[model samples]
Target chain A: MVRPRYFFSETFISLRRNFFMGFTAITTVAITLFVVGFFTIIVYDIQGIISSVESEVELAVYLEDEISEELKDYIEKEVLSWEETDSVNYVSKDQALERFREQNEGSDILKEIEGNPLPASFEITLSSPEKIDQVALRFYDKDGNYIEGVNDVIYGKNYVNKLFSITAIVGTIALLIIIVLLLAAIVLIFNTIRLSIYARRKEIEVMKLVGATNWFVRVPFLFEGFFEGFVGSVISIILLYFVGNFLLIRGERVIVDTMRIKELAIVGSSGVVLYVYIGVAVLGGLIGILSSAIALRRYVKI
Target chain B: MNMIEFKQVSKIYEDNTVALKNINLEIKKGEFLFLVGPSGSGKSTFIKLLIKEIEETEGSIFIAGRNICNLKSNRIPQLRRNIGCVFQDFKLLPNKTIFENVAFTLEVIGKPVYEIKIQVPQVLKLVGIFSKINSYPHQLSGGEQQRVSIARAFVNRPPILLADEPTGNLDPGTSEGIMKILSRINLIGTTVLMATHDRNIVNSMRRRVVELEEGEIIRDQKRGVYGD
Candidate 1:
């Protein structure tokens, strides 16, 4: 039978006896988790902003001035039929000219024009911004020729390409950094546990000599490691709550003020942050347990 | 039945230093024997082998008719559970109280709390340290600490007890006190094997004596003194 009372009492006693070592281990875990949490929040917020921006990307297919009403309706319907197309609205020449006039109000350049040079076009929004290039290609034929009655398809090709590449690079770098931080945390925790074990080598020898099973000798240390990790993670989570809120509030204000957006959801609702906190705490505990197991393998010989 | 048997047992360390040469010895149940040797002799090695702390380079050993040479690693704890051990340093946990130090033996073996409550005080009283049950090891004198150590070893009432220089650090008066406790434990029908260099302790007891030199037993005699 496993005696939980004994294990818990032993864990607490040892933790108290080696207060300095325990303190060092807890502090190490807390600092590492805090840094990692900060980076995670940053990456999540950046991805949120990028995705919001990507949603605004659209494709504009300019039409011939003399195209038949039937051809215009056909073009609109065809673009809407594609799975990537979210919506397609036809803008007549008059509507296009009116929009330009409104945009360039109080400017002499609009008054200098005699007749409307703006072409009628179909403004298309896609379900997925990544498929904009492929959807735009559908406007052309086998020889790279524009389809009949279609003049040109423009989706700011250069800008979309740059955005995609930037997102990919940011994602790769963030993943690599998190991986390196996790490995470093594991190694440092392993060393601290090894030191603590070394300090109590005599205790272990005595325990073994008295016929304590290997697990009987090991369970308390494992509990110690887990407690350190759990406490450390709670500290980090509390710190992250304050720090994340401060930075995100300022960040939301900046984005809203400059970009004229009504609200910027940096890391989604509070519910998502709660889940992230849970994940970090679990990760912290697993690391502590793993490091303790590794350190004990060499020290707690039966 | 023999409590311990060593057949041509030898332990040669990795650096080619032989700690115990090919040797044979048998100890019967309830026997009290003293292993006498100088510092470099195989006294410590013999105790270590019985507990399976280190494997012998050759030959076999049996404890209670079980060959421990091929004993599985996981079963070693079971083997040790039947054998109590005492050391020269009196390896009591510094952080635990006298009561806790003795109670630890029963705790590791999954004994019930009620049993621990009854047995710990019983053993501590036997070693004459019941008055200091609440005191920590560091707070006690050398002899008091050794008494607590003996209580811890004998608490579970194992069949065999091995004491490796249990009085090596105590004065002659304290050593006599420790020997008295060991003799009392042996009187309860527990086989006792003690290794020591104290000539007075060996001479006064006059039990069976096995003397070792240079990793080999040079003398084995009944009703022996410290020497021939």
Candidate 2:
């Protein structure tokens, strides 16, 4: 059998002969990888924003003016009995009045209210912050309707649920984008390899005619594809680093400022990025070579 | 002993066109055989079958001792290496240097670079193309390119050389020059099977001639001169 060096030399010569087509193919692969990379950043950015908002809201339960102080104390103990309640802070009418007055610091209308008209209230904080709705249900009146005087129960329900749903939707959309981009990458690589093979179709046919074994003809094209992909992937990873940094500068908190996000895009996702770059480059090259090799199946006569 | 033996070979193209009909012939080693016919008279079809380019419709073609008709498709390349073919178009690889083109057959067959380095130039010299070793096919004249094609065929030292209208594009002088090269190779004991209609070439060479008419062999004789 001929040595592998011979096949590599031929493949190298073929690549040099049609440098432009190979360049174009590499460019196509790079673009596909970039699209996949960019959208990944966007998906991460959106998710970070939503989780930040979920950490702050709490539910407030208002008491009726007619309810006796003893019953109010009993309700406070009952509220604390639930495992879901993180903490309960009680405020008397006078304390509520004082707090309202303090909040309206510069307003003269605060002095016009001669009496302490505010009701006592309980500020409910939940363990999960996500179960605000169920906790609010416990604040219902005897008739089982929403309490009349309860101004608001603001414990993280809206924010948590909203972020959760939005993240789910965005996550799905991002996944769809990734899948579509991946498919496009494969097709593009396949076509590029196919065209490259077509460019050297005669050479391949001649090789077959001269009694070159199947591997003899196949190895070089595979190498060409691999080289193309390797080069393209290197170019892609370099571009992604700069681009990722630019996005971070434009403000992705996930992109730390101390890190020149552009420079760090490569380093920040170092582990994932390396895997992606090498995996993609190798994948791109293999796909490109295999496509053409397979296409040559019918045309390579004895 | 006969090096090539065909027993009732026929070929029907995929398009249903009958290209060869019941061809039975023998080609001796160290002898030059010419296959002659008009257009569409199965000359090319016969060559294709011998090289395993196209399968026989219903027949057996034996090269050396092996029946090529029964060989598997993957084995065709192996069969082709034993036979050298010169196409009408002088199908030299446009991208390759004359030397590289010539050496390709040997290279594909897993010959060592050192051997290729030695034999390729020898074959090119044999075809009077040693001077144009570095030249691409397009840079050479049609005749010169055909010489490169011939050199490429013989570089591997194939047992049989098949020339399909090798001089189809050359003038009479170039054709005579090519014939001289073939005759020289034949003198050195390489079997040759060429197809042509040039009567002058046939008469002057006085080699064995196999004539095909309407897909059937009409004549086969020693020292034949373009027999009808």
Candidate 3:
């Protein structure tokens, strides 16, 4: 037998009467959610950068200059058959000389080279960047000696290991910070709701004396909390949409132009922005309702 | 049949202050009674017990022949709906208009809009405050605000009405007007129990009077004056 019209009207009227308090509550929610949204976007962008950088990790396996075409083909197939290997491409000695000349087109280094002295090599990408060392080690025997016709394997093992560990640490810290921020937002909302309840205590007393059920007295306040949260979250989402776009565009430009690392540039897709908006809005509303419920438990005695 | 009964009821506060001790009283349906006492005589406690605001430490209270001592906490609201209450300060919501203040009572009980529209104005007119239906509590005089509060208390037509010093803050003339309204409401067969300190009102009404002293009833008389 709940009446929606009456409850809503009551909520609106109370909100109007306590305009200053309601405004304060809404502002607090908006600012807290805004910070949270910005942090989420930053975390997502960093993760994108880390994953792209991981994908660029590859092993260059140089071959002996006297190797036959059949042996080269066999090495390519063998590397590809490993579960961790994503793809492998064979570069001939002439192709390597051509790439060196192209990289130093105007330099005297190309003129100083008499004939092609580069060795044929296989460039191998891995499905899991962390397993790059294990894949590169496949060309050697247990005695750490290269197998027949293989010259040397190079994959920058030190930097790859350091990058994986750094990414893992960054991921853990980002998760912890987000959890702490969410808890802080909930606490701030709870205090704001408690203040609102204190201001309307007399009205609550009168309602109880007039035969209002505890729920009847509670519904209007709950609606007030939900309305405040909804409005606050919408405001934050709008702010985040504009500010996030500005930041992402500038950040991507700096990473691509100055650092010359195209893989580090974040792609701010519409789908990711939409998901962030929905998550922030829902979180704000739930915080509002939860805080209101807790505040009323102590104040709205029948 | 008795509309309210207190059987050997007692109430002791957490600080060990005895507010009421070994109280026994019965008020029948449609009767008007006055409770008179000095300060700290437990007049407020008597009214509070009827509404179950504070529980009795001993004995039972029956409202409409139901023992309310063992009534569950969730059922307290249902019990309160059967009784209407008024206060000395005219506890009208400062933000609500006279019409809304009256309508609020029915609204909380889930009355339909049409029914509330019909009933709120009718009760406002009953207390002679129909002209100020749209006026907020702060905009009205003390007597006018009291009238609005009365209208709110009577809107639901509960079986019992309790007023705690309803005229304590008004002048003699204004008090008389409030008394007349209470008397008129009583004429319609709604049992009223009012606690007051105004001797003039008690003497003028010539109704059943129960006087309390230090948490115990000192006198109960039919058509009793303020005192001998």
TM-score of each: 0.94, 0.78, 0.89
- For each model, chain A TM-score? 0.95, 0.68, 0.88
lDDT by residue for model 2 (B1-228), tens? 879998988888889888888878988888899999899998988888887767788988888977877788678778888888888897678877888888788878878889999998788888888999998888988888888888888888888999999999899999999999999888889999999988889999998999998899999989998964
- Lowest summed lDDT over 10 consecutive residues: which window, candidate 3 chain B? B91-100
Deviation in Å, model 2, residue A92 alpha carbon: 11
Residue pair clashes in candidate 2? A58-A155, A245-A261, A245-A262
The better-scoring model by TM-score among 1 and 3 is 1
In model 3, the clashing pairs are none
- In model 1, the Cα lDDT at residue A93 comes to 94
lDDT of 2 at B171: 95
Q: Tell me, per candidate, how large a share of the native contacts it keeps.
A: 0.69, 0.79, 0.69
Q: For model 1, what is the C-alpha lDDT against the true structure?
A: 0.87
Tens digit per residue, CA lDDT, model 3, A176-197 = 8777876776676677677777
Q: Which pairs of residues clash in candidate 1, taking residues 3 or more apart in a chain or in different chains?
A: none
Candidate rank order under TM-score: 1, 3, 2
Best candidate according to TM-score: 1
lDDT of each: 0.87, 0.77, 0.87
TM-score of the B chain in each candidate versus the native B chain? 0.99, 0.96, 0.98
What is candidate 1's lDDT per residue for B1-228, written digit by digit as tens?
Answer: 999999999999999999999889999999999999899899999999999889999999989998999988888888888999999999898878999889888988899999999999999889998999999999999999999988888999999999999999999999999999999999999999999999999999999999999899899999788884
- When 1 and 3 are scored with lDDT, the better candidate is 1
In order, how many clashes per candidate?
0, 3, 0
